[model samples]
Target: MEVHAIVDDLAEQLSKSGERWLHASAAKPKYFEFTPVELFAVTERMSLAEPTHELSADISHLVEFLHCVKNLKIRGARGYIGSSNVVWNALPFSLHLCKNILALWFTDCDVKMVSGLVNIRKTAKRIVVHYSMKNIEDLLLESSSIDDPNLLERWQRVEEVDFSFNDIDSIHPSIVLLKTMQRLNLSHNKIVNIGDQLQHLAFLTELDLSHNAIVHIDEWHTKLGNIKTLNLAGNKIANTHGLRRLFSLQTLDLSDNAISDIESASAVGKLPVLEKYDLRGNNVLNTIEYRTRVFEGFGERFTEIELDGRKADDREKDTVAVRLALQKAKKEREDLARLRKLQIDERIRFLSGEEHVARSV
Candidate 1:
């Protein structure tokens, strides 16, 4: 038998079963569980009976089936659609019919599949559209200007966006139109520079741009000052020159980067309220007296921040104290030696002057 015939037969059987259950349920107490396929059939029947009724459904199999047979219609789905873990060549046509969907889960689907999400732009509060492909700017943004009515209408209310694990090389300039956006995750992409693409998002707080090709941070104070938690792990960052301005930064993750020297890495210590940090994979981790040097560079905040993963223990604190004392002593000694040399030079000059004067007389 063909797939269509099999599906038709299963739908008929399930529909009959649903009808029998509905007629027999008033008198006797009975429990029934419906599989995804059965639920799809029964729900379709219910929708046909009452076209205006809203329903939540797990439509993973339905989406896969629609991929094979493009003409299939899913009639009554207005709330949550679980289409996760499926390889979608394109979003199924039935998804366009769901105008009031609460949350749409498209995890592990190809990025090309999101091209069909035009109808649910305003209804969906949370849309998880991540997993590998290219060029999201065309998929989401049609105009370059942030004030474009088309762009604002499409993404203004979206609060959180996760575009991780894609081949995105740069952030779309129009992402600033999401005026209500708070959290954005662009990790595991090919991004290199941030370059004012995100400066206007004043409400954005948590940003994850880890595991990319980023080298320089490009003075993030103006661009990311409102951000509270920042993750730049697994990149090619060598310096922290731009981080001193993050007055509200609380948690910072720079693990698995290319930060090589203590002077370059110590810039993170200037972040005012920084409480936690991870620098486990940087080359500076092997610097001579690394912890002590970093602790000293951080000035008075050595006791306020957590290094690697944990706060400094008694032994480490004592080591930092001893190192600081020794460093102060070394500086004092150098100053004293310099002063003595200057005095000796002055005395020698005076003796030479006196000898010359005596000879002249």
Candidate 2:
């Protein structure tokens, strides 16, 4: 029988048993293809959740098929909770259900609901939470309690956490609890300082604090020697002097800030390994000569610079300057061509006059 048929048979058996089904049929087989360890990982994780009469019947059938299935993937679980308007207060139980989740992406979800999901701290490898500021304070407060030796052991496994587009103002003291975090994205928030609370995230490789109210990136206590991607775009930062300390940075985005002149742009251009620079929508368009000068100063260090997305007035000035330059060059070329043609005609007339004189003689 085909894999779908097999999955359908398994799903029917599971439905009859009334257990929470992973519905892995939606995920690609390659992602879920299992090795011996991976198979054991899934089974071990499933054992942690409380088995209901309904869940038990479903799980029994799924366990039988688990032997044939090489991979197990779960997808499209959006708002799986209907608006029964009943608050089940199932935080601990749901957290236990997510024990083996390797990746968790929560976008536009209510923050209050997410606080409950954090209970499965030991098993999740990566977690991305975006556009949820309402519950950030509560989430941070709860996560900070993981300082217990046993809790710290579980928290250390998380590799990446993206909390962008939230209205977070202050860096929570609890964020310091994540010791093994490799990538942290806090872009598009209202944060101002790079306080000492960040020093605890020792293994961070990619840090994005872009589009915030950040005035400076210097207050960060952690040595960013291992950081590779740093995006500080759309902030209130006026200078680039503080960024020179990030030696391992490869991609740096500082676009749409309150940059006054080319001096600030030049400072960022001088970074050792910076390959792409985005300065669009900034005050760099106040003077094109200075912008060009800064770009020239960078020489061949940068591959591309974003300059076209300036305000309408700046764009008009750039367009006028380009048109004026082209007009001047075109006029000069026309004048030179006319001069050459006049000289050729004079020589032709002289030759014709000489020939006529010789014929008359």
Candidate 3:
């Protein structure tokens, strides 16, 4: 069937519903000529009717139509909410329509209302809310109702959330409910601490707390055990003492912070699982020689380390080469030292004429 024909059929089926439902489905796929209200109702019905259910192939066709008509330009598992007025007003309905949505990207959408968005805690698997209508504080506060029976249960399914560029002071304790979250981006916020609330995120594997005001990373909480990637760039973390507890970490970005010397850099290197590290754009980068020395001291452990991207070349590759050369040179020096000691002992025997002075004597 033609796209428009399919939309028409869906709209006809949807109009049988009430006004609230119709208004919500109005933003349905363009293929259907139904009014926005009709489309909205269809989506509402879809959401409330099914759990653990897959949308029909026809629904996928409708998604495509919505993508074209709404100018969402989305495909595959991604949904784009860029510059769409529908996102701001029909927040709840839009989410209701995307019953099977796995990813949502809302860039530059005016999301002033919190109530409508709360319903989204259930369906979306991955969500990126950048340059949105509400700030982090407002969103966090809105989601703080632990007493809400459905809120916590729904949020647990979310795997990734990016709230970068939002004005947030601290992560609320209520966020612990998102136990399944794997990646969280809180960059460019006004946060100051790796607070006690963080202990709840046991499943978090990647955490981007960069560009914040955090001063320290506390190792007291063992809950960060599963974390593999952590970005503390542009923060006030001056040392690496607190990082020892994140034993499973493989990638760490600490560039552009207050780290002053090779000592702090070496401290990070001691991490057994650390494979990639970023020390670029920090005071440590000021001394080219010290940067080289620290990597050498760490031996052949790191696979890659950021060199501030300042050098007019492939600095990381160069550093790796230098580390290899340093290891070879150290081994050669050890061999030379052993030979010298043997030579010195032989000369002493000769000078004293103690060589086989007769077994008879």
Name the top TM-score candidate: 1
Q: Give a tens-digit lDDT track for model 3, residues 159-229.
A: 89887876667776656656678899989888886556556677788889999998877673354647888
How far off is residue 168 in model 2, in Å?
1.7
lDDT of each: 0.64, 0.57, 0.59
Prediction 1 global C-alpha lDDT: 0.64
Return the lDDT, model 2, position 71.
Answer: 26
Order candidates by lDDT, high to low: 1, 3, 2
Worst ten in a row by lDDT for model 1: 69-78
Query: Each candidate's TM vs. the true structure?
Result: 0.64, 0.58, 0.57
Q: Give the best candidate by lDDT.
A: 1
Off by over 4 Å in 1: 1-94, 108-119, 142-151, 154-157, 322-361
Ordering by TM-score: 1, 2, 3
Once fitted onto the true fold, the runs of candidate 3 whose alpha carbons sit more than 4 angstroms away are: 1-98, 108-112, 116-119, 133-151, 220-223, 296-361
Q: What is the lDDT of residue 159 in candidate 1?
A: 75
In candidate 2 the C-alpha lDDT for residue 252 amounts to 70
